[model samples]
Target: MFDTTRRRTLEWLGIGGAASIAGCASQAPTAEDTGASTSTAQSTSTPKPTDTDRVAADPADVPDPISRSESTHHDITLTTEEVVAEIEAGVTFSYMTFDGQVPGPMIRVRQGDTVSLTLENPPESQMGHNVDFHAVYGTGGGAVATTAAPGEANGMEFQARYPGAYIYHCAVTNLDYHISSGMFGMIVVELPEGLPPVDKEFYLGQHEIYTDKGVGESGHHGFSFENMANEQPTYVVFNGEKYPFTPDRYGTLSVEQGERVRVFLVDGGPNYSSNFHPIGNVWSKGYRDGSLEPPIEKHLQTAKVPPGSCFVGEMETPVPERIKLVDHALSRVARRGLLAEIDVAGEERPEIFDPNPDTAGSEDEEGSAY
Candidate 1:
């Protein structure tokens, strides 16, 4: 039944050609046909990638929390580069990224800190790029001052005036195209007192991939302008790949029981809001829109992280189980490949949840609640 539903969904999207619906073929839409920039060399498909072509950013690569009370000035530099990398085992995409990684890098600072940021567009870049930080108080949120063309460098300075997690992304005229192709990241401004410490922290970014090829296609995929304009994404993935942190790809995010964990998520969605939820657990504390202000919501089953927005959610791992991080927009997980995992390892508490016990033989053998 699930396969049948998935097939119908793909067919509705005009995904694969007639014969390539359930399966995939080594073919992709042309750049000219899809309105993708030619920088990625998508005119011709390439063979599957080697180790050097994997571009998914590591989830564990996060900056430590700000521990100081005094404000300070920081210098930050980001380079914009266009690269073609693997999106899945058999699929590839042309990504316009900051520092050559999706969602760029996390920028952390304390409230009232001065930030001098530089954006460099290398000579090899095919499109101009700039950053518009949601935390900045300036023209276009510093986008106007930092718009750099190919081979040029632009700089701007701003004071982190608020305490919140903010999203920074390309603010060019074609920002939707760039962001959907992987050009956004998070900027965390810590409060004066800073946030409560957690046993573990994981940083992740979510964005839709608008590709010309259908899901499961075994070749290079090109950016689709029509799809973007229609807000129909081919894949809604985390960290630039389908189920990137799962055991099948990169290993799961492991932690011990009874530990408190915090996840910082920035949604780079040029379109589509993420119904962020953790299966088998609830957000013990959720800071919506990434605000660390008082009156934090508690015990949320799901939280909406909209496009161009952010979320900071905390979880209490009291039991040993694999918690699945997913967008409650069910189809996105069932079909479009949006998934992450948190593996909690500890002894099972049968009193809380028992898979099998002595009561197993008490019910009717041939009857179920249904």
Candidate 2:
């Protein structure tokens, strides 16, 4: 899948010519050129209250995905910083984050609401940063208006004119590198009537990590510019870490049987698309690319979530089982360390799923079906 996509990307780049992209990628921004303020007074001042303060105060601090509120103005703040963190047990990489988390905070608003967004590049950040919201309809999707340098900040106001889940990511020069390094998130503009409530909601972001080292290599890994340009990644992971959702590590997503679950997924791919699928379950209702219109695809086995896009899918857990979430790209799961699990706990429904039916009279107690 990546090979095909990489060929296409290369073809597109060749035909459109890489001159412009090369020019953009070549001119790395310097602190002076980025207009980072150096005033002593500004340096000593505290950060101003962001829009999130006025409304959804400190909502980004939590991991639970946020839901839409009543139609109104929303103030959202996103700060950019860089951190070195473990990608897996032994592998580590430098990540560019929003508000100190990969995939950033889930920003929710209703169609027709006004969004006052603030983008800040902290003093500790190493480069300039900006945001491009796929839901917006203006130049670079508000990127041009919101580019901020280290210690600097910028703001933009736009109406949430559409109802959908959209991808938002850093749009600075060499955006592919920035996004691949973990500088993206999702913004949900819900319909006026709102979506049907579910028993659980989980947010996940998918992005590939292009490291100079191979997977599982210990010690700090550095970004591979060559691999990124060729669309070859060493790891494709969820929530910015390898297999972080498994019970053996952080914990598995738990829910009762018969409960409805909604998974909000964002693919921050600087390159490949995601063939998002759950191993033992299907999307009972799917809002592809966050579309809120009628004719939502039902009972979908998998959905294509492209780079700079979002998907909202609901599942009905009818049986007690573990559902593995994966990118059907296969290689990502089989090789690149992409995995998540949802453990459904409740009384077993033998009528629906009988694992021991064939072994009822068998003498092989060790081989009882499960």
Candidate 3:
């Protein structure tokens, strides 16, 4: 079933003809480009492991992705769990997820709201896990205050002092490995006045998974530390699987033509950066790094969404078409599994786009000649 659905969607999107339509291109900054040193050594400063006692929380129970507190004070709880799931038709990956899902859950709060968070590592987990919220303004971005080993729980309180979307992920000794294994999420701190109203909103996360087996090898796969260190990934995917946002699979994101849509994207890539682009559409307003301040870029064709960062973009669909959302890195789409679709259903406007062009029958020789 999965293979059939994926192949049909790929054919419909013309994957063989063109990966994506031409658009404004932007380069994402890498460690070398930004003059930042990449750390390869594991931490040895922490104390040796010892049996610690704490209440174990159920990893399955977590807040809904769209759930939010109406009051000024909010309490959030996250539990770490390790589970094996299929990445594609016959490819399996052992994912370390927060609340048992890749990209964790979307946390929404007001700018001035006080948030109390709890990090729980279930006993079944083999390693320790912690969370560092980019929206926090404290030590280690609240990682130090909430690090918990398996069978333990830790809590901390912080104020959402600023308004923006932020990425949160494990900050353990092997931070990169943990994040690449699907331990990350986003927190949106809305401004007091809130954002502009839109007809629809969607949340997605992009991450690369490195495994010993090659792409589409079709068997159980294991994590490859060597590939991770070298920044080579077997799969670069949205949500958790290949071609999830297709009509036959999980279902494409649907919106009516002429409706305004917003997309909140968090890149959990422990490695490669995401050149986020919506083929066949343009971002009327793009808030880089989830910033809502002034100087929002207008009519952007693509924007760079770095690892551990968020991006917010809005679009106005003028015609009925299937918009293909991608990283804009052609190789990733052609080789690795990275693709999504947004289906805009409504009456087509031939004035804007003619479905059938009469090239052979047209009398204008100059314009019709191809």
Residues 1-370, candidate 1, lDDT per residue (tens digit)?
Answer: 0121223322333444323321122344344423455333452465344434656778788999999989999999999888877888878777889988877899899999999998888777777677889999876687656666666777799999988999999866566777898999999999989999999999899999987778887787877776777898999999888878888999899999999999999999989999999998999999999999999999989999999899999999888988899999989988898899999999888888765578687555663311
| CA shift of 245, model 3, Å | 1.1
lDDT of 2 by residue, 125-170 (tens): 6776778888887877877667666666777899989889999998
Better of 1 and 3 by TM-score: 1
Best by lDDT: 1
Name the regions of candidate 3 deviating beyond 4 angstroms. Answer: 1-71, 360-370
Query: Per-candidate RMSD vs. true structure?
Result: 11.5, 10.6, 14.6
Candidate 1's TM-score reads: 0.86
- Residue 140's C-alpha lDDT in candidate 1? 69
- Candidate 1 displacement at residue 100 in angstroms: 1.4
Instruction: Compare the candidates by TM-score and give the number of the best one.
Output: 1
Residue range with the least summed lDDT across 10 consecutive positions in model 1: 1-10
